[model samples]
Target: MLFDSGVRSGSDVAKAIALGATAVGIGRPYAHALAVGGTDGLVHYLRSVLAELDLLMAINGYPTIADIRRT
Candidate 1:
């Protein structure tokens, strides 16, 4: 399942995955990015989120998003 609402950082995505979420979502940050920075902000925010998620996965010992396990 995809998680949302409170999801803000890569760590949050990792947590959701660990709890059995197959996917995560972009909510306020996404909207805010677009509104505040236009296309550039949205693009930047998306990349940041992706990078954060990757970093979190590595820190949590998951080689990939598919490998994240339930805590």
Candidate 2:
């Protein structure tokens, strides 16, 4: 699937995976974070996005990102 742009949240990441994306790419958000908070901020943002994706998977009854395909 085509990602619109830089994903803003983990939920967005989950949605992309659930909808069948081969990978999630970061661009704009990283640039923005980098400009605003540098590497550390970018790291924090990326981690939060990952955590959110995991939580969404669990709450949606998916044990893993692959499960989202079946869901």
Candidate 3:
């Protein structure tokens, strides 16, 4: 399994997954969110990232992470 770090956005996560990353590190964004608005902010941030990833997958016709790797 490969772990990719330094991810800043949903797009970055998608790209890393597409490039065969088994997992990703997204600590920076979470840290920023926590510092800005606490737990709620972190929750919102995570939901936003997932939503963005879902949108990108739909736009690209990728039904799953495995499908993304085929691109």
lDDT of each: 0.84, 0.79, 0.87
Error of 2 at 42 (Å): 0.8
Q: Top model by TM-score, which number?
A: 3
Instruction: Give candidate 2's TM-score.
Output: 0.82
lDDT per residue, candidate 2, 1-71, as tens digits? Answer: 66766578888777777788868777888888888889998888788878888888778788877887665
Alpha-carbon shift of residue 66 in model 3 (angstroms): 0.8
Which pairs of residues clash in candidate 3, taking residues 3 or more apart in a chain or in different chains? none
- TM-scores of the candidates are 0.85, 0.82, 0.90
Residue 23, model 2: lDDT of: 80
Model 2 RMSD in angstroms: 1.7
Among the numbered candidates, top lDDT falls to: 3
RMSD of 1: 1.5
**Runs off by more than 4 Å, candidate 2:** 1-6
Report the alpha-carbon TM-score of model 1 versus the true structure.
Answer: 0.85
Residue-wise C-alpha lDDT for candidate 3, range 5-28, written one tens digit per residue: 778778888999988888877888
